[model samples]
Target: MVLSVHEKVKSERLYKAFDLMAAKDLDAAETELHAGLSDAEAQEDKVLAALFYSSLGVLYKIKKEFPKAWKFYEKAEKLLPEDPALKLISARLLIDVFGQFDTAIRRCQKVLEISRSDPPFLHQANVTMGLALLKKGERTKAVSCLVDAMQDDFEGLLSASNIDLKLVEALLRKRSGLEECRAYLEKALRFAESKQEERHVELFRRLIEAFPTEEATDVKIQM
Candidate 1:
């Protein structure tokens, strides 16, 4: 496809934003990303615009502005109807930004239906689907999704939020399999504690404190 003047401008601005991110100047990155979004809209570059929105959502998430992140993610999802890449990225950002587990699940489900064993984004879709299901308390379903994601052999795809296959294992182990879960959570707790990610550490701690060991086994998912 031929690139329009506005699209070119937007693309350049987007590049600048990524450069800023690479330099660890998050604020500057956000400024450049916003500029790119503006140009993309002006040019009516729907695909590029959707991508920029998703990028904005990720930036906002790193900045801890969850609501703002969700706003941009929703925009991306709305704008990118024809592109599976755009849809999948938007969906993953929805989970990272808003913690809207159900919405993330739905998006992952849609991608599973459409993705034809492609590279890159297909792997991402699997990881996002797994995490979404996990967050929604669907232990069995979550394990299935994540296990499917693991088929891609991509590790860094979903590492930004300290969630990965290990986290999934810990969560499932704690709920479904007693000895296995305890061991997993203990390992996860060590990692979280060492990283000083107190919030995450507290989450695991709460599981230990709130429920009896026997009760942890055979726990039904709420959602």
Candidate 2:
């Protein structure tokens, strides 16, 4: 279906706002989004309003304004509750920023149920769920989810965050499984080498050195 003139204007403004964000001009991006959001609100366009709200949420996240980000994200989700991306970001922000571990886990559970066929979404939901479970003091289950995420979709895990680094750090902090940690870094090292992510390769190398396996072979993943 063809977009009306107002819709086309809104779309153009959205693209322009992102262009500003890509250039790291976050203040300008915020201004652009605010303007677009006013138009969406004036028009009573829930879809466009949700889009603007979500974009504002991301902007605030980049600005490290977690409270404001969550506020906007909630607004977006209220308008489009079934959107998986909104739920995922809500889970992430809850876990990483808001310290609401149980809430994040519940959001991730919904994602897991709804996103079973979407591998990328599933990978991130699993990993994030594992993190939330870990924070909630379920060590055994957390490790199981983390390892499963890595084993099932290493590439997909990488697509979202610094997967290996986060996993290794969590294990190290917990002092849970040195063998598993070492193997994780080893796999990450290989991926970094392949991708030519030199800094990550070096970081993984250093982390692997700390583990120091005597066997000089691949450590078996227990999960």
Candidate 3:
């Protein structure tokens, strides 16, 4: 399982690029990514090249350079057409950057179809699909997808995110059971508390306040 020198160099560059990107040093990040891409190309490793391209796509997307992001994603997809993770990224970009909900939902569905054994990817695909459906005015289906995502999230990671809040809001708007909506909001509240997300904490607090005493009491907050 030892990596060749080229793979080692490529991996190091990619990791550095990711760190730089996290620090908001976009120019340095882009340079490191390009260096990785060059090494990957020199090695004739399509998988490595695809990975670098996908990273570049995300970097450009974060910078709001949609065209460049799309171009890099397209290149990545061409190299790894069956990659579920890349497909999920492309779907997210389509929904968030390109406003292509239908296309994004289709891409997510495709990923879900192929990524049955990968629960983390499945959760992400479902969340992306739910978001796309929500944007498409299909609240009922959106709620279904979001619920599926939350149910699949055995680690509770996804349930602690704003996606849970989105689910609660959707259910409330649909006049779902008071206890059901409270349950989601409570999960969100715990997540906010854990992350020290004050805004989300306040939001959940306000939503919980709207519920009756019995329903609020029924919603248990996890420590």
Instruction: Give stretches of model 3 more than 4 Å off.
Output: 1-75, 152-181, 185-223
By TM-score, the best candidate is: 2
Tens digits of per-residue lDDT, candidate 3, 68-149, equal 9999979988998887765776576566545768978988899889877766667677778877887788877877776676
Each model's lDDT: 0.61, 0.69, 0.69
Residue 53 alpha-carbon offset, candidate 1, angstroms: 5.9
In candidate 3, what residue range of length 10 has the lowest lDDT sum?
1-10
Candidate 2 C-alpha lDDT tens digits along 104-222: 88878898888776665666677778778878888887777667656743564332224424544565577665666666667767767767777776766776665644443333322
Candidate 3 pairs with clashing backbones: none
- Considering summed lDDT, which 10 consecutive residues are worst modelled in model 1? 1-10
Report the lDDT tens digits of candidate 1 across residue range 12-100: 77767766766778999998888888888898888789879878887887788999989987888788655665565556546655466
Sliding window of 10 residues with minimal summed lDDT for model 2: 1-10
C-alpha RMSD for every candidate: 12.7, 10.2, 9.9
**TM-scores, in order shown?**
0.44, 0.56, 0.49
